[model samples]
Target: MTRYDFLPRLVALPGVYRPQADTRLLAAALTQEPLRSGAKVVEIGTGTGALALQAAARGADVTAIDVAWPAVLAARLNGWRHRLPVRVRHGDFEARTQGLRFDLALANPPYVPSPDARLPTRGARRAWDAGTDGRAVLDRICEAAPSLLRPGGVLLMVHSGMCGVEKTLELLGREGMSGQVTERALVPWGPVLRSRRAWLRNQGLAGDSHEQEELVIVRAQKS
Candidate 1:
């Protein structure tokens, strides 16, 4: 079997459906912030628990949630491998978390539109599709985030630039919150390349192999 078929392989899968340069960049951004040792942190869609593990490594108390059972198991194993303390749980981001509030929340939710989507493993449907416009998951998270966060808490999320960044800003504004782009980068959309390339070829841009995906990291704060 290929390495990807191994249980440990899940830990190496991309957190986002596509390659996300900004997601890794957000890790650096988190390092620069005032993340006190043992600060409470909650991560939504904790694929492979990469970000959550990073936070835990910095001595932060972290709870990571994912709808995918295999991903959760993989994350737990990854945490074990690194000797990091991160609680990986199978849960939905839109649901309330047992009255728990956190100092920091992070999510790299699925922001890809349907029709051109790749199915996550059977256990990860909610982790991948964001509905027709690709904002269903994000909308729910934004709506629920204010309640999940403590006063002065922050929520960090990464999404595609094509997923309507301006609209996201507007939604956060309506939620009585504010956000700023902490990082942005161009990365290849390896997940949808087959469909994307087909569409490009149909439009007579076949030779234009410069198709790129944009990654935007936004940090929102509840007033």
Candidate 2:
């Protein structure tokens, strides 16, 4: 068997965010969990349904939501391609899944801090570019996590350290949710960060000499 035989073959459309190091890192952490068959799982920002497929492959009932129409289509196609049953939704997580809770919540949201104050409504950048502080999407996830998860449910979210991991923990903590960093990795700066080097330095999120950033996976559980 080749590597990643477990995951479905994915086809990310043009302008859709493709899986990268961060995606693999989250998937690795996910595999370690004792996921039972038919567990309810919801993946936010399910670009190409990568993580959603991961859960489905393990026999979990999964629902994947994406804000971009192209991503929704890609995810549905990938699910069909592999014969995995994933309910693909077209909308943001909080809005689309309101009043619903899941056994597991997964997110790999836009955490890259962009110079622009407004988030991109259209373009591939929407998949990666958060607002100036990079918390535009991360903050929303932290706030919505408690509501999205059921009692004893777990949230597995990945984001760049530039957005403030402690802040994520703090936001969850305010909601009485307990959280801790389960994984961390330093990855070399990618094209996006390289282009924003000067701005990131200006915002004090990165150093002029820094060449890498930490990607953190936080596992938070509801009581």
Candidate 3:
């Protein structure tokens, strides 16, 4: 069962990314993590702060960030409404580290492989469009995980398997972090994926008229 097996309803402001398969997949994996009491946690690309709220509910102090301003506002509102004490910040999650580290790091970043060569600078597209290979942000996170996590801290991140799970595991290993797929789920294509069905098929990221996509939750522990 997913931590969001009973995903609490949240007010999704216009233009904010709504929680979906990737979110629930990670949430399920989160329930398996060793979340100690009062453990300090951070979530990049928090979106509506749903996952951050989940971490908080586990009795962990949560800090979350989103690059989209509207998402930032929505997350803040949700945190306030739920009284989760999630510090929702609007900025680049990677650049705003400021030397702070966390016991656990979580993310469900934009991993939809798109035709566009560059990640969108604005709009809702920024929430899901990773460059052509869908590793733009994922690669950045893998590189930044070492800096964001304290020794032995764990990073739990979710993304489409279409983006290459092996690469993530390999990258984390290179950083001295042993990682594995703690959870995997095959979810049907949502509106976003459905709309880009043809493009995805052309890129071989999807099967012919593929109706489902695989999602994976990678759990990496920094040593």
Predicted structure with the largest TM-score when compared to the true one: 2
TM-score of 1: 0.82
Candidate 1, position 140, lDDT: 81
Query: What does candidate 1's lDDT look like per residue over 1-223, in tens digits?
Result: 2112222333544332322454576666676667899899998887777778778877889999987766777788888877788988887765637789999998888776655445445633555566555787788887887888898999888887767888888888788878888888888766654465665456443356667877888889998
List the candidates' TM-scores in order. 0.82, 0.96, 0.95
Candidate 2 lDDT, 1-223, residue by residue in tens: 1227644457989998888889988998898877899999999999989999989988999999999999999999988988889999999788999888899999999999988989999989999999999899888888888889899999999999999999999999998789999999999999999998898898899887998999999999999
- What TM-score should be assigned to candidate 3? 0.95
Q: Hey, what RMSD does candidate 1 come out at?
A: 5.6
Model 2 Cα displacement at 165 (Å)? 0.8
Error of 1 at 85 (Å): 0.9
lDDT (0-100) at residue 88 of candidate 3? 80
Error of 2 at 60 (Å): 0.5
Q: Count the backbone clashes (under 3 Å) in each candidate.
A: 0, 0, 0
Model 2 residue runs over 4 Å out of place are 1-3, 6-8
At residue 44, candidate 2 shows an lDDT of: 93
lDDT of 3 by residue, 1-223 (tens): 2465336677778888888778877887888788998898999998898889889888898899999989989888887877778888789987777779999999999999998888899898999999999999999999889889999999999999999999999998898888998888888788888888889889888888689889988999988
Q: In candidate 1, residue 37 scores what lDDT? A: 90
lDDT of 1 at 208: 62
TM-score preference between candidates 1 and 2, better one: 2
